[model samples]
Each structure stands twice: as C-alpha cells, then as structure tokens.
Target: YLKKIGRRGKIDIWLVDGAKIRRDLEKDFTNFAEYYYFPIIPKYEFWIDRESVPNERRFFIDHLLAEWRLMDGGMSYQRAKEIANQKELSERKKAGDLEKVINQKSEFSPEKVHRRLLDKTKDEIDIWLVDGRLVRSAFDIGFTEGGHDLVYQYVPKNEVWIDDDVFAKERPYVLLHELYERSLMKSGLTYLRAHRKASRLEWRARHSEQILDEFFLKFLIKKGKI
Candidate 1:
C-alpha cells in the first residue's frame, strides 16, 4: 500500500480512505481547490473563511513574507560589511584603543587584526566561537525583543546593538563564550561545524520560502480546480 513514488527528500504518495471517502472528496473538490485555485482566475470570486484555514498554512505564508523582507536589497552584503566595520571602530574607540586603531578605511583597512582573526581558523571551533560572539552581541542589544522599543528602533541603520541593561542583566556574551568554548574543548570541531552548517541551512531556508510557497500553490492546482 505504501509504494515509493519518488526519491528521498522529494517523495510523493497517494492514500485511500474508504471509510472517509466522502470527507476526503469534499476536501479535494471543494475546500482545497476553492482556497488555493479559485484565487487564480481573473474574475472568479473566492471566499475563504478565516477560521477554516489550518494554522500551519498561515504560519508558512507569514514566515515566507518575513524572510523575503529580511533578504531584500535593504540588507545587502555591502550594507552588512559597512555596519560591521563601523561597529568595530566604535568599539575600539570605546575601549580607548583609538591610538592603536588603524586609520585606513578600505575593506581591508584593519588588515593586521582582520588577518589575525582569519588566520586563527585552526579549526571549525574558532569559526563557531566567532559566530556565537556575533549572536550574543546582537542579543545584548535588545534585537531579540518583540516590540518597536527594541535597539533596532534607535539604531535604525545598523542591525546590531549593545543594550546596557540587557547585557548587565543576562550577561549572555559571557555565557555563550563559556558554553561554546566548553563545547569546542569537549567535542572537538564536529559540533562546531554542525552549528556553522545549521546557520547556513537556516539562511537558505529563509531565502527559499517563496519557492516553497509556489510549490504548495502548484500542488493545490494540480489536484484539480485550476
């Protein structure tokens, strides 16, 4: 009964339910096609009851839009690099390292230190630590908050922040540093590499949400009411 229809990760299957045939047919012919396909027709009137749609459907659609906005031109690679460089310089100034800080202003202006960090990549552990530090710093800045009162409001241009209260209260930076360092020491680079790979996977997932939505729409259409 469970015949394999495709390769793994892209498999499809058909199910039959004699007892619930009426319910299944109603869904296939009316509910699914009405909500998904009727909207496609130029002059077709489609009425969807808000309470009828599944929660997962709404979640998927909303998440797709959110990811699309995040990866839009507003947060381009050049913008990210510029923000990172400015924040690094500001931190140096705050730490009274102004005298030692470099004056050049190109992509590789702080060449020595940047090169040092890049060279310290003895293993994946080092890269994970760097990524953890970046995440911890963002958390300290109130970027994790749910409202408009977050650090993002005041520091609108940059996507990172340094909230004094949050930093003092939770000390997430120290915790993350300790946790990652301990994980690195105990498990070697395996866990660290997994973390890095997971981060990349997350980015890809966010970027591909729109494609997934289109796929779902196509599925609904192929089932009939297009």
Candidate 2:
C-alpha cells in the first residue's frame, strides 16, 4: 500500500508496524528518500529521549532568563540554583545506574531542590554592578511557588548571566508557557489573562473526562460485567 503511493513526488515514510510486512516489500520500500522505524518503545513515555531532554530544558530556561534578565537586568541566585538542580537530576536519570539510588531515596527530591534554591537566593540583591560600582537595581523581583505567596529578592550582578543552576528547576509547563509567550511576543500578539485561564480550564475538563472514563471501565471489570 505504501509503495504504490511513493512513485509521485518526494515521500517521507514512517513505518510504525513495518515488521509485519514481508521481506520482499521491505526491500522494495528501502529505496524511498527517507524512512524511519519505531523499533523499541521508550521507557519514559511522556518525555523525550535522555539525550534531547537537556536541550529542551535549556531552551526554556534561556527564554525565561532572557525575559527576566531584560526586566530585572540580572539573574537571581534562587533561579540559578533551581535551573542547575533540574539539569543535574536529568543527567543522573539519563545515566540509568542512578535509578536504583533514586528509587532508594538517596538522591535529591525535586521539591527539596527547589526549596534549597529559595534558601540560597533569599538574601541576594538584584543589582547591576559595573567596574566595582552598583549601577541599577531591579524595581520589582518576585518569586512564587504554586500560588500567590510572593517572595521578593534584591540581587546585584554585572550582567545577566545564566548559570547551570537556573536550568534544572524549570517545570515543563513553565517551559511551554515561556515558548508560547516568546512566540506571541515575536508576533506582536497580546495574551489576555482571561483567555489563558479559560484554555487551562478546558484542558482540565478534557483530562477529567478521560480519568472518569478509565475509572468507569475499571469498575465494570471489577464487577465482572465487561
């Protein structure tokens, strides 16, 4: 079926269950411009491969730091530490051997790492220092966890610099939001708070429906009726 349609223009083929095909068809189809196969399913289903995951984290942290750096004109110690810890944990997980240590609770938990970040940045003042002189201080620097408890810090630095620490504590949602905001900012589009809230609510609604459906299926199985 795939080969019959490949004669026309350039075709990029993705073979999901190509192993089921006869060897003759496989040989004939190998002449395509490009072909890829999904041989082994990844252990971590929701995330990308270990090698690529750090890049994804770096992309998000860079965006966030760029924005915050512009606003405050420098980076905070807490944010820096948070980003570093996230990258470290990712590397440890990628090594595979650390999985046993992680399971045994010998490694740092994500929450504890984030808390440690808060502790480290608590006293630093966001100041732009140039040639041993304090230049500009951030007017407003705010850090919050989960909800609305605002913690403000003042830190002074020469220029906006992103260390390894700030890259590690970035959450997936934070990265996605930063990317979306950057795209919107580039396009000169303004995002409304109400619209953002509605979008999140809609996602939760669909997720709840899926969870309910799964639970109902489990109930039927428990009752021996499915």
TM-scores of the candidates in the order shown: 0.20, 0.19
Poorest lDDT segment (10 consecutive residues) of candidate 2? 128-137
Clashing pairs in 1: none
After superposition of all CA atoms, the RMSD between model 2 and the true structure is 23.5
The digit string of per-residue lDDT tens for model 2 on 146-184 reads: 111111122222111111222222222222232233334
- lDDT tens per residue, model 1, 123-194: 222211122122212222212211111112332221122221121222222222223333343455554564
TM-score, model 2 to reference:
0.19
What TM-score does model 1 achieve against the real structure?
A: 0.20
* Model number with the top TM-score: 1
Badly placed stretches (over 4 Å) of model 2 are: 1-139, 143-170, 193-226
lDDT of 1: 0.27
